[model samples]
Target: MARLRDRLTSLSQPRYLAWRALPLGSFDPRFARLRIRTLVMEWHRTRETPDDKAWCEQTLEALGHEVTPGIWSGEVNGLLWARPRESEARR
Candidate 1:
């Protein structure tokens, strides 16, 4: 039946994967970096404006992430690295 198929599809989806992938307790620098890189790539692909970039940066800051320039694949790019803010790290 259609309802049964829909239920099977929902069950097959990795719904809990996001929770499992998240760090357990303490801040995760690697995860932060990856998130920043993903955001940067999305911005590039979408040709986001500077205002949008700034908004993203602000959101990261609000979430206790510090964005910085770093070398990625032998090239310098802004937001290549993201780490927990010093204040957040001590907690």
Candidate 2:
């Protein structure tokens, strides 16, 4: 069971550095504005219940992204989100 958990956890790990027309180390400020959604549900290995989904959604909102019901290309293709800082929530 532990091995399974570890494997599942690793599934959410970042596989590649770039996709979605995003480049490697481009340093483009425009891409900086994009909000990336995180798969917080992946934190637990058992399951993704409604409460878990809500928690993920709320967490994303707290992060300031207008997250939808589906995973973003960033989360799907790559294991990264150029997430904005918490300071942005104050503005």
Cα shift from native, residue 33, model 1 (Å): 15
Instruction: Tell me the tens digit of each residue's lDDT in model 2 across 55-87.
Output: 444555554654455343233221223234556
lDDT (Cα atoms) of all candidates against the true structure: 0.45, 0.40
TM-score of each: 0.37, 0.29
**Residue 65, model 1, lDDT:** 76
Residue-wise lDDT of candidate 1 within 24-67, one digit each (tens)? 33333444433322222222212323343344456567667776
Output the number of the TM-score-best candidate: 1
Error of 2 at 64 (Å): 0.7
Off by over 4 Å in 2: 1-50, 71-91
